[model samples]
Each structure stands twice: as C-alpha cells, then as structure tokens.
Target: MTAMEQGGTGMAGARRLRQPAARPTWLPPGSIAFCLRSWAAVMLALGAAFWLQIDSPASAGVTVMILSQPLRGQILSKALYRMAGTLAGAVVAIGLVAAFGQDRIMFLGGVALWLGLCVVLGTLARDFRAYGALLAGYTVAIIGIGCIDRPEDVFTVAIFRVSAIMIGIVSIAIVNDVTGSPTAWHRLAAGLRRGAAEVGQIAHDAVNGRATPDDGAWLDLAARIMALTSQVSFARTELADSALRMTGARSAMVAMLDMISCSRAIGGVLPAGAVRPAILAAVRRRFGDGTPFADEDAARQALNDLLHAAPADAPPTPAEAYLIERTMALLSYGRWVRDGIRTLEEGRAAPRVARDVRIARQQDPVLALLNGAPVMTGFAAAALICVLGGLPGTTTTLLQVATILTLSITTFDTRAFGIGALVGVPLSTVCAMVLDTRILPYGSGLPFLALMLAPVIFAGCLLLIHPRLMPVGLNFGVFFFIVLGLDNVHNYDPTQFVDRNLHYMLSAVILFFALTLAPPSARRRRFRIASAVATTLRRQFIGRGDIASPALISRQYDRLLQARTWTGHLPRKPATLRVFDRIVSLGDLNGALARARRHLARAAAIPAVAGQVARTQAMLRALHGPDAAGRLLDQAAHLLAAAGHLPPADRETLLGAVSGLFGAARLLDRNARALRHYGILPPPEAAP
Candidate 1:
C-alpha cells in the first residue's frame, strides 16, 4: 500500500505506518526489505516446526516476530538473549514443577516468586540484557501455567517451546546474514565520528570562551559512547574485519570523552586572563573555530609552538601549569581521534588508549524489589482469579498477561508497552478473526496458510522495524498471531477463537492495571533514580573516608550518567543541572579523599600528620545535621593545613584533601538546592 493509503487507517494506525526516516537511495527501502525477510523467515520456521510436529508450531512464528530487528547486531544480540532466556526459563520451570507439583497453590506461589526475582534482576541489567531477564521471568509462566493440569508434561512443554524458538532463531539468523543487512561496524564508525565531532566542538568552544559544555549533555553523550562498547562483540560476528574496526572506534570514543573531561577540568581551574585568551586563539586558529580538528599534525604543531612560547620567567603556578598540560593532552587526544578514524577506515587495530575511569552503577535493592511488585502481583491475581472463578483453559491467558508485563518491566517506560498491548492485541485479534472466518478455509495446508498470512505478517514486520512504531507494532503483531493460536491441524472454530481473544483481552486489561496502578511512571522512575544517586553521594561524602572505592564511585558516576541520558529531554535550566553538578562534585571529592588517604597512610609514622588525619576524619563523620556541611568543610580545611610539616609526599596528600574539601564547599554554596538535598543550610531564597 502507498504510505498515504496505509495511513488512512486512523491516527493510531497512521502512527504505526509512518517511517521515522527516509531510506537511503543506494539501499532498497529498508522497511520493505526487512518486512519481506521477516515474513520469509517466519514461514520457514513455521514450516519446520509443523513438519517436525512441535506442539506449538505458531511459537516458531512468534519467535521470528520477536527476533526481527533492523540491524544485524540487534538481531544477533536478541537471538542470543532469546536462547539464554529460554534455556534458563526452561530449567527453572522444570525445577518449579518438580518441587511443588502436588500443590497447585505452592506451585503458583513458587512461580510468582521466581517471576518476581527475574523481574528484579532484569531491571538491574542494561538494554537487551534486561530483556533477557524479563524473558526468563515470564518463560516460567508460559511453561508452568500451561502444564498445571499435568505437571509431568512441563518438561515436554519446555522442550517444545525452546525447540520452536531455536528453529525461528536459526532461520532468521541464516536469512539476515545471507541477506547482507548492514553490519554493526558501520554504525560504530558513525558513532565514533559523531562523538569526536561533538567533543571536538566543545573543546574548541571552551578555548574560545564561546560556551562551556553542558554537564548533562556531556554525560549523556559519554553514556552513549559507553553503551557502544558493549556492541563491539556483536559487530565481530557481522564480519572478520569488524572486530578490529569496532575496537578502534571504541578506543577513539573513550579518548574523545577523556578529552572533554580534561577540558572541563582545566576550565574549572583556569581564570580568564591574557594567557587564557592567547591559548584560546591559538586553539581556535588550529582547530578552526568550533569544527572538528581536520589536521592533527598542524594542530599538534601549533599547540607545541604555543607551549614553547611561554615565558620562562612567568610565575610557575599550579593553575597555569595544569592549563598547559591540558592543552598538550587535548592535542594528544585529537591525534588519537585521527588515528582511530583512520583505523576504522582501513580495518586495522586501533592504537591503545588509556582506559577512562569506568562509570559506576549502584543498584537499590529496594527499587529492584519494587520493580517486581507489578509482575508478581499480576501473576498472583491472574492465578487467583483463574482458580477462584474455576475458569478452564484460561491459564494460558494469564500467562500471556504476565509475559506482557515481564517484557514491559525492564523498559524505562512501561506504560508504552502496556498501552501498546491494549491496542495491538485487540487489533491483531480482529485481523486474525477476518483471516480465519472470511479469507481462509477451515482446513488449509501449511503452504496455503503461509500464502494467505503473508500480507499480515509482512505488514506487522514492517511496523516492527519502524523506529517510532516498534512498541505498538511488535506488541500488536506478535500477540495478534499468538492469540489466534494457529496450528498444523486447523480448528477454525469461531467460538474458540472468540473465547481465546476475550481471555487475551482480559489478560491485557490485568497487565494494563498492574503497570498503570502500581509501578512508577517514566518521570517518577527517573526522579527516584536521580534521588537515589544524590543520596548515595551524600552518604559517601559524610561516611568513612574509605567508603569511596574507585570502583564504587565509578559505579555511582555511571548511574548518574544513565540518569542524565534518561532525562536528556528535560529542560536545561532546573535543579536537575544543579543536582547533577553536585553529584559529580561529590564523586570527585570521594576520589580525591581516597587518593589522599592512601598517601596519608604512607606518612602516618609522623605523629603530626596522623593527628591531622584523625581530626579530618572526625569532622567528616559529624557532617550530618543542617549547617554542618559548611562548618565541617572549614574545619577539615584547617586540619588539612596543619599537616604542612609532614613529609613532602604526605603534605601533597593533605593539599589534595583540602582541594577536594574546597570543591565540595563551593558546590554547596553555588547550588542551594544541592545543599538542601544534603541536609545543609536553607536554600538560597529561603535563607534569612
């Protein structure tokens, strides 16, 4: 159908039909090609499943539908997860059935606990890893729920389900690989270039005093770069050379991020002066006014010249020295970017770059536990209703409901899927009804069924690949076919079909309420995460000096980066920016304190330095009540300075601790909201 003709279906349908971006001239329209490939793969899988006489041949099609993705890497990653989740789920199902087969209540309770645990675990993982957790969560329901009448058949059901999924996965993999869908390396290259250009522009701007980089934007971009590192393995599977190219791309991306951080660090320390302006002009002249540096050699040459011209008699101050080093680091950073791009282009190994400090992620077990409440409650309610109402053959429907919720649980936005199911499931049901009652005869063979079903499958897959349409399209399309429950031996009873759909509809309703009524909305989830991050930083700062491990702080920063990415669409001006800066300041303080503590330990034989360390530690511990932050910071600084008579290395450590203390104090004074969040003085406006 023409785009216009397809869109005429209505607003919701039109949204599904709308492609987010136009396809390239060199490539066939990707959606059309993807749709066709997916249809063919599903057909092959279905044929294989039916020919082999698997119990649920339609599951083969569902598998294909689930695995259909536009990129080769996405398909591979998803297929791997599908296999892992299926296997894990099957194993758990067998255990659950074995343990409590005699007591339906016990079995149901066990299933709910298992599903909840999976949901909790899934929320802790990132991206498709989370999907795997969700898949494992509901796969238990799919296997165990259906076998409730005969627990002995759970193993058989698990095997058939896994076998059908494997067939679909293998079919799609072979087709997608042979069809030459774009490799992950191409996307990796694009990501590298984009990140380099962005960081380069920010560096260029900082030199010229045009604009400082936005903390949120920088963190969001860094998080995206970090995310790309995970896709490297997926790229290697696409082609032999992709591994080398992707590795180089990843190195370059990390170096670019470090460059941004260095630039920000220098900007924070250096005051605007004649030297600063001269350096900015030299950088602007070399990098060409806010564009990516095109000539690494010339840029390096210019920066070297600028460094050499520094007056020998000029006062050697820490800030000026740091600025000079930052400039040199920027030059080195640009060269790495250049080498990385060249490596990707030539399919060669990238030069090794220093690994940036890994971002840290801290999980709130409370949040994870809360995340599962909806999934667990939904399953429990569905089971209770099924048992209490004595609804025969409705267990499968409850499983579907739990499966939908389990899938939705890992997403940043759960309501989208819940809403998608409400629309997609019923839409699919209608389409299935039309095909069964009007178009296809009661006893069509496999080939005939594939022929008649091609359009539906094709259209569904088309929508599945559309970026804007994915949630609705996939949910609607897959569930539509699944709820229809087509079989090798056709039982085209309209009453049965209608009855199944009603149960499916009811399932969707339960999921909708579960997601809507219990779990936090997207904004709320973001806020909770952000709050947790702020709270974590506060605790680290006030707690024992040793609490801030490099690894632990890295995780907290990583979580902050994730929060920044999630809330990128939030307006730039707000407490969000202030809060983020404070969190980062705390992180820096934690690291600095850790470094100083290590140095102080080496010099602890000196009684004076040891005494000063003890004093700072006491004040830090007392940093709790309102107005304590500023007072404790001042006291810590005094105690830090009292170590001046210590060995040179220990004195340096004391200086570093003082510097970190000053940074925390500045953050509190500058951002009143941040201070208030940490139980400091009243906010700026409210201060008497």
Candidate 2:
C-alpha cells in the first residue's frame, strides 16, 4: 500500500472511533411508570369484577381508566369525589324510576332537567369538584336510562354500578400507594418557589424601569397563579397537616398577585430618566434575584432602609409619593411571599397577617346558565331522535349522548371533544375487532389476558401523556374497553361490534352539531367581563366598595384575571386589544382607590384632618365625567396642604392617602375614554 492509502485508512479508523454508540428510543420514565401502574390497576379491577360476577364487568375497567392520574394525590382526591358523585346520582336515579316509571316521556324529561342542573353547577366549579358535578349528571343517565325497559331492576343496576366503581377506586389507590407514586405537595412546593422567583424578577425590573411586560406576559403570570389554587386543593389530601400547608399556599398565591399589581403601578409612576433612585438600587440588590429574607427582623430592617432612603428634609412630589408607597408595598408583599413559602416547606401556620387573607374567585351566573342550555337542548333532541327511530340500540345511543354532553361541559373546547370521539370510536372498534378475533381467543386466563392487553393500553397511555393528544387518548382508552365488552362469557360477534359502534359514532356527530350550532361567543364573553369591571368601578365611585383592603384588592384581581383569560381567545383586533388595555388600567385605578380609602380611614383618627377627610369622601362619591379627574387632583392637593402642620408619623400617613388619590386621578384621566365607552361615565357630547 502507498503512504497516501495508509493515511486515508488511518483517518477512517479515527472517524470510526469518534462515533457515538447507537441507542434505542428514549421514553419518559414518569409516563412509563404511570402506564404500568394504570395497567396493573385495570387488571386487578377486572379480576375483582369477574370474581364478583357483576352485570357489567367492563364498567370496572372504564372506571379505572377514568380515574388514572400521574400523581397519587390527584388520583385519590378524584376517586373520593367520584364515589360521592356516584352515590348521589344513584339515589336520584332510584327516585326518578319510582316517580315516572309508568310514563316514558316524564322519565326522560326528568333526566334531562337533572342533567341540565348538574351541567350548570359543574360550569361554576373548578378542578375535581367540577368533575364530581359532571359525573353526578351522567350517572343518573347511566342508571335511569339503562333501566328504562326494566324499571323494577333500577335498584339492582344502581347497586352493581356503585360496586364496580368502588372496586376500581380501591384498586387504583392500592396500586398507587404500593408504588410510592409522586405526591402533589412536593410538586406544588417547587412550583411556588419558582413562581416567587419569577414575580420577584418582575418587581425588580419595574423598580429599575428596566422592562415593561405586555398584557400577554402579565396575563400568563396571573394564569399560573390561578392554576396553583387547584393544586393546593389536591395537595390537601396527601398530608396530615394539609390545612396549615394549604393556608400558606393560599397566602403565597395572594401575595404574588398583589406583588404584580404593585409592580404595574410602580412601572407607571417610575421616573422617565435612566438614572435609578438610590432606594431602587437597594431594592434591586435585595430582591432582584428573588431570594426571600431569612427572618422577620431581616425583612423589617431591609424595608426600614428602603423607606429612609427617601429624603426626609423635603416632601415628595405626587408621583414620587406614589412611587414610594408602591415600592414599600412591593417589599412587604415580597416578604409575605417568603414567609408563605417557608410555612409550606416546614408544614407550619402562616403569619397571622397573611392567614386571614383569602383569594377571591370570579363567578358569572349568566355564563353558567348559557353553558347549561346547549347540553339540555342537545339531550332533549337526542332523546326525541332515539325514541322516534325506535332502533335496536336506541337506548345505548341516548346513554352515549348524555355521557358526551355532560363530559364536554367541563372542557373549554367542545368541538375538540366531539372530534376526538368521532375519530377515536372507529379506531377503537378496529382495534377491538383484531384483539377479540386474533388475540383474546388464544388466551384462556387473567394473566394471558393482561399480557395481550398491555400493548394497547401502553399506546393509549403514551397519547394520554401528551397535552395536545389528551382528548383523543381519553376517547380511545375509554371506548376501547366499552367496545371490547369484556365479560365472564366472551361472545365475539362481529355484527354486534359494528352495530354498537355505529350508534356511538352517531352520538358524536350529534354532539358536533349541537356544540357548533351556537357555540359560546368570544365577543359576548369579552363584553360581559368588561361590563363586570365597569359595574365594580361604578360602585367604587359611589363609595360602595368593600372596606377591607385585602378583600377589595383580591376581588379586583379576580375580575382582571378573568378579563385577561377571555381576551386571549378573542381575535387580535386593534379595538379588542385597546379594550383589554383599558380594563387593566381600570384595575390599577381601582387598587389605588382601595389603598387610598384604607389610609383615609387611618388619617381620620387625627382631629386636624377629620374635616378634610369628610369633604374628600363626599367629593369621591359624586365623581364622574371627563372633568372628575381634575377635581380629584385639586382635592388631593388641598388635603395635603392641610396636613403640613401635623407631626412626622401622622403627616406621613396623610401623605400616603393623598398620594393614592393623586394616582387614582391620573389613572382616571388616562382611562376616561374607556369609562365612557363602558357607560361608567357619560359619553362625549356631539359638536355644535
């Protein structure tokens, strides 16, 4: 061989040595673990059901699939609620059979009304609580409609259904506990820590005037905080001292929201120049990285330094005073965030100040009623069709309709639920066909049956783990078991399979039309949220707002968060964006007024300022029109001048009250156009 050839061979050898080893595809360990646990629970449930000789052994398997969750806490909590819902529904089912068993029309009508009421309640709830409400609705359908032909057997069927659900719940709980699955509290704690850091960063940026996050960013942060509320509830089922831990978690969430409000207010009043204030530099150094103070003394000392950083010789301008008030509030809330996190970690009570602060939730009765209408109407129509057609599987079709409608009530996108059912039913039917004919026929025992079912369950589990594919996976997993129709005596009939699945598909198509015909309007939701905010502001303008600062601010935050959620779903039109921005500004104005009232109540104790406080309250009640903002500024100035003769502490309190009023006036001027548009103020006059 020539030298060139030898050199080429050496280079190839080097390349071969540098190449990495080939490996099989990677799967998430958590997903695999969850799948194995779920599969084991399903097998156990099936074995128990078979031994008991239940009427519908397949229902047990369906229950296990429905209750499957990654976290042990979620599974157990949901199982509890599911059992409660099942029992409540069973009781109602028995009553309906006794009262209207002789009249089919009355029985069906009663079922529809019960389902409608459940849907409305479910729409108003959150998390597993909502699931419980929805489950109660459909359980009535399952029991009452399943026994329409044999009303005498209603009680028997109800007993068997509840038994199957109990078996499934116990199986999953045992499996999860033996496997030592992850706890929700651990995950929630980590999330709370991460959220505190993120919100701290936002506060730091606001103080330094470094960044101004858009509406989307702020809204995203708010959503994360709102989501934690559900997690806190779930975590309560996992620990002994859950009440204390949950109290701390609630405080942390409330503080984070208050911190965001302060950050936004500070951003608006921050000096335009690039030069940062000395106190701001102190704030950035202390909390820029989001680390909480170690103790109360440390937090107090740090805050004291921040307050003294402002010049004592000269009084602050209106904007400067506002900035100082917001900064102080930011630091105090940040300390509360730290304390709350510590309480969660150590499983102790939160500080007394934060223990009483509750996060308020937004409720819309009109929206709930609107959501119930579609479900009720769809059920009525489906019942008419099934009764009129008088087909072989008409009863089964009505059951499917009730299930789909009740389940879809909890989901934001009903169309997706329909689409998932449409695609999943056929796929599940085909898989059941192949499995029944080729696989299950060759198996004779429970072990062999579980072995054959493993791959199908695993595939469904993989899809279920993905967020985007969850709806499809849910439908596939649930319908596969139902369509398979597993029992003590396996009758593999191809015709029965095809006929049953056709009815299921028909129900999905009906759901699609029912949901799409008059879907909940995004524009209408936006208008309602805006109207709510305007009503709140109008009440505040007339001195009818809540007196407690925490309650007032918490309620305002809830409304603003709801607005942010709906606005994201609307088309990104300029007008819509403007309306959302105006809503946020209004929230800030609301907060400023709340804080002003709190401080005014304090300043009222001083005899020197009592007369001025009375006049200011009267003026606030009569506030309106485009010129109302100017009058507010004038009144705030007068109050400040009157307090100049007081001592330092009293004068400082008076200044806080005046500063809040000034900030409110400025915000009112900025949002005057929106105020008129929402009918909170008189509309502009036409030109002469």
Candidate 3:
C-alpha cells in the first residue's frame, strides 16, 4: 500500500498484478528490411529499368537515389557524384579516342591504366565522399573496354550517357519530392515523443523499484531513440532545399529530440522513493482498479489537454524546471522543422530564425583523401586494358566503371563490395555488343530503341513501390542489363562473353579488394562491445526494479555505451547501434557471472570474495558516475588474484572473479586494460 511495503508474491501474483499493454489500435509498422529483401528489391528495379538496353541505363543509379532517401541525405549524394564522374569520364574518353586513332594499341593501353586507379579510389572510399573520386577512375574503364573498334563513336555515346545520367537524377529527386516525402520534422517529432515516453516509463519504474523483461526491451528502445535524436540534428543542418519545408521539418524535429533528451536527464535524477506510490497506483488501476495513468481517462485527459495546446497557467513546478528546460529545447527543434516545411510549400528560400542552430560537424578530411587515392590506380588499370587487352573503346568502358563504383559507395554495408564486381562485367560486354556494335550502325535501331525504352515512364511514377536495394544493387542490375543487351550472348561466342565478363569481373573484384584492404578494418568491434554495457545498464537501471542494484552489472553496461563513440571517425549511418545492442547483452551475461560468484563466495565464507562483490557493485555505480568508481575495481582485481590459487572446482570461482573484474575494467574507462584500444577515456574524475 505504501512505498516501503513488500509482499511475498510469487510469479503468479506478479503476472496477475501486471496491466495489459495499452493501445487497441497499435498496428506495428513491422521491421526494417532483411538482407534478402534488400538484395531482391535492388535486382528487381534494375531488371525493370534496363530491360531494353544491353548497355546499362543511368536509371539504375537514379532509382538507388530515390530508394536510399530514407537514410537521410546519403542516397542522392551518391547519385550526384556518380553522375558528375560519369560525365567527366565520358568527355575525357571522347578526347582520348579522338587524339589517337582506333588503330593504335598504345592509346588503348593508356585508358586501361587510368581505369585501374578508379578501382583503387573505390577501395579507399569510406562513404559518399569517395564516390566522385571512384567515379573519375572507373570512367576510364567504361570508356576503354566498351568503345573498342568504333573509337570515333565515343563522342556520341559520351553525350548520350550524360543525358541518361541527368534523366536518372531528375527522376529520383522528383519521385522523392512527390511521394509525401518524409520530412525531418515528422521523424524528429516521432522520435521526441518516443523518447519522452521512454523517460516517463523509466522514471515510473525507477521510483517504484520494479524491473521486468519489458525494461530490457525499453533500453534497446532508448538506444534506438538516441539514433533518431542524432537524425533530427542532422536534418536541421544538412538538408539541401533551404526552403520552408526543410526549415519547418528541421525545426520541429530538433525541438522534439532536444526536449526529450533534457526531460529524460531530469527524470533520471528523481529519487526512487518519491514517485513510487503514484506509479503502483497507476499499475494497480491498469490491473485491479481498471485505470492506468497513460491509458486511464483522467491521466489521458490531462495529457491530451497539456498537448492539445500549451497551458496558459503559470510556469511548471520546481520538480519540472528540468522538464521545462527540456520542453524549450524540444520546441526549438520542432519549430525549425515546422518552419522548413512551410518554407518549402511557399517556394521560398530560408527565413532567418531568432537564434542560430548549433551543428556538430566532423566532415572527415580523411575520407576525401582516401577517395582521391584511387584515381592514380584507376588510370594505371585503364592504361593496361587499353594496351594489352585491346579495348579499342576506352572511354565508355571507363565511364561505366567510374559511375558504378561511385554509386556503390553510398552504403556502408560490407557485403556490397561484391555487388559492384558482379554487376559490372557482363553488363559491360552487353552494352558493347548491342549499342556499340548493333544499334548505331543501323541508325534505324536508335529511334525504335528509344521508343521501346519509354517505359521509364512507369518506373518514374512507381519508383517507391519497386524493389528496394542499397544504391549499389540497383546500379549493378541496371548496368548488367545495360551493357549486356536483351539476350545477345549468341551474337558473340557465348564463351567469349562469359570469358570477358569473368575478366572484367576479376578486374572489379581486384579493384574492390585493393580499395578495402588498403586501410584494413580498423577493428572497432571491441569498442562496440564496451558501449553496449552502458546501454544495457540504462535499460536495467530504469526498467528492472525487482533486481537488486548490482553495481558491476551497471558498470559493465555503462562501459559498453561509453565505448560506442570512441571510433574517432564517425560514420553517417545508425548501423553502429546494432553493435551496441549486441555488446550490452554481453553485459547482462557479466551480471549473471557476478551473481554466481556471490553465491559461491557466500558459501565459502570468503571475506575477500564478499569484499570483491561489494567492490564490483561500487564500480558499477561509479560506471554511471565516474567519481563513484574509485578503489572499487582495484579491490575486485586484488580479490580475484587471491582466489586464483584455489582448488580445481574453484576454477569457476577464480575465473569468475578475474573475468568479472576484467570486464569491469573494460567498462569503466577507455584507459582501463580492456578498453586501451579506444584511447579516449578521460582520467577517472567523478561524473558531475
């Protein structure tokens, strides 16, 4: 009945006391795309776009642009660079072919060398920053390999390729704009609301001293919310339109993220004892009393009124100063997002806001450098193919390679490296056979082909409904179709087509290997594991009240969360959050480990072991707040070393003691034994 009371309730009582989950209309949006879905959508879109031409259509690149828009600004950014690189490479090819006649083998050799450099560039690219550089290099390959004997026709193809690329960019941008585009404000608003709800739930659980499986789920939910918060800030800064739509969207989204962040921070500080009764009452209503705060008529009415319009009453309670501070921050981001949308609708440029928005910018200079590295390599590769491989057509070959490589850089997914290789080879031959050999000479084929290709109209209208893939997938499919005309393998020796495809495939694969292995994977997996500790702690701390406050559990999780951002080179995607979740689960395992040690130590009546568990809990509390961790972890280490000399069955005891302590060190600070690789943890000053 009161905060201090306890009941000898079994699991049956717990379940009976628990309220059913709220919301009768809560239809799940389902999950994000699986690897298979991503693969299929990409292949499907390309098949549809390039059914007419054996030489790939730029439409594939463009479609990737539209489909990738949900990832913030990256999708279009990739397309833009690829288009530029393809055009530049095409023009350069025209010049090279014109200066040297098709009869000269040396001229073709130069082209092959140039394309090799492009592959290296693609290899170095971390993200879209390297896309253009890769494009510049591959441009040589497309030109060299595809143009072959009809060197004079390089100019005509170059012009057409550029035109096709423009069509693709426009198509993606327009389709994105028309399809009730996901405004920054909408996303930000949703994230803020979600974050706020999490804070509320966490505070209620914290005060009432309750922990449930849902709490663990909630922690995962919170980490994801942080990701959305990051997105809101990015929108406020990175949006291109600069119109009312963009401004309004950014404003609203920013407001929501900032507000909820502040609100949660304050709510986290509330003492567990203060709000316990009110929470139990709410839970009781949801179960026995048939009324819950969030779901009941009274609380829902109060919430609706509060949100329906800002209250005209005096300022909030002192308990809510933090909440109001959070509210103001939320309002700022919300307003910016709202203003952006309105600005877009009005067809106006940005109208200055009362205050400036702060942007966290770390546009890596290294990414640009890495992107540039491939140019020299690509040129060398291009030169080789031109001379030794006898690619009479250098420019078109180089153009295709450059464009595809550039387009592929949009995704951070490791697997996509292979897609670039598989897509480019056969498509290169197909384009060479159909457009290079068959269509232009007849002159009659061009008009008919153009008419037949007009089905781009349907693709344009239903771009969103088509298969979804990373930008690279669509690029590969389109290029595969584009270069390989519709069923023309028989015209050339089927083996020759296959052989050439394999050759180019090897070339692309070689390029991919070159680019990626250059820097190696930086090996950030450990850091991800560390950051997961923090996320897990937050979830356990906020949601699980029944579980005793095991400090090492908290410490281990905090360490995981803290390790998340230590990778000095920040990536554009939210994919890193997945790594954090995995590591945090490991933190949960550590808790079980500590509990087992506690049972064993209590049985043995080892004061040293008892001291170690206490110290471990102390370390966990300090994990959340730096100052509190002092001397606790050291004691854990000392106790474990003492336990190490015990008997064989005592192996579990000694191992648990040492392993748990080591895990604690990993969680506590970057300089700690386990986290030394991160190299950014501050000296253990207490958290303010």
Question: Whose TM-score is greatest here?
Answer: 2
- TM-score for every candidate vs. truth? 0.78, 0.89, 0.45
Per-residue lDDT tens digits of candidate 2, residues 1-688? 0000000011222232233634533366698899999999999999999999987898888898999988888998899889989999999999999999999999999999999899999888888988899899999999999899999999999999999999999999999999999999888899888788778877776766655455556656767777888788789999999888888888888888878777766665554332236655665565555555556566555544554565667434555555655666677678788878878889876553376767667678898888888888899999999999988777778898898888887676677777777777677777888998777877699999899888878878877777666777888887788889897888877777677667877877787787666667777877777777777777768777654355666666667777876777888899888888777777677667766777788888999889889888777777776788888888777876676577666766787687778878877887787777667753334211
Compared with the true structure, what per-residue lDDT tens digits does model 3 show for residues 441-482? 454432454443333322222232233332333534444444
Off by over 4 Å in 1: 1-29, 213-220, 239-247, 265-314, 338-348, 354-362, 442-447, 521-557, 565-688
Instruction: Give lDDT tens digits, candidate 1, residues 1-688.
Output: 0000000011332232232656633224677788778888888898898889998788999989988887898888888888999899999989988988888999999889888999898878765677788898789989988888899899899999999999999999988878887767777777777777777766665554444544545555666666676666566666667655655665576567656655565455544352455554554465454333345455444544554444545432233333444555566667777677777778765454323423335666777888888778888898888788877788877788778877876565566677778778888888899988887865467778778888888778766666556677877778766877877787778998887778888887877777666556445555666666556545544554454333443454466665665555466777767655555654454444443344445444557767666766655544443464476466544644464345444444454455445444434444455555555333334332
How many residue pairs clash per model? 6, 0, 117
Candidates ranked, most accurate by TM-score first: 2, 1, 3
Please give the TM-score that candidate 1 achieves against the real structure.
0.78
Backbone steric clashes in candidate 3, count = 117
- Report the C-alpha displacement of residue 344, candidate 1, in angstroms: 5.5
- Candidates 2 and 3 compared by TM-score, better number: 2
Comparing 1 with 3 on lDDT, the higher-scoring candidate is 1
**Cα error of candidate 1 at position 562, Å:** 3.7
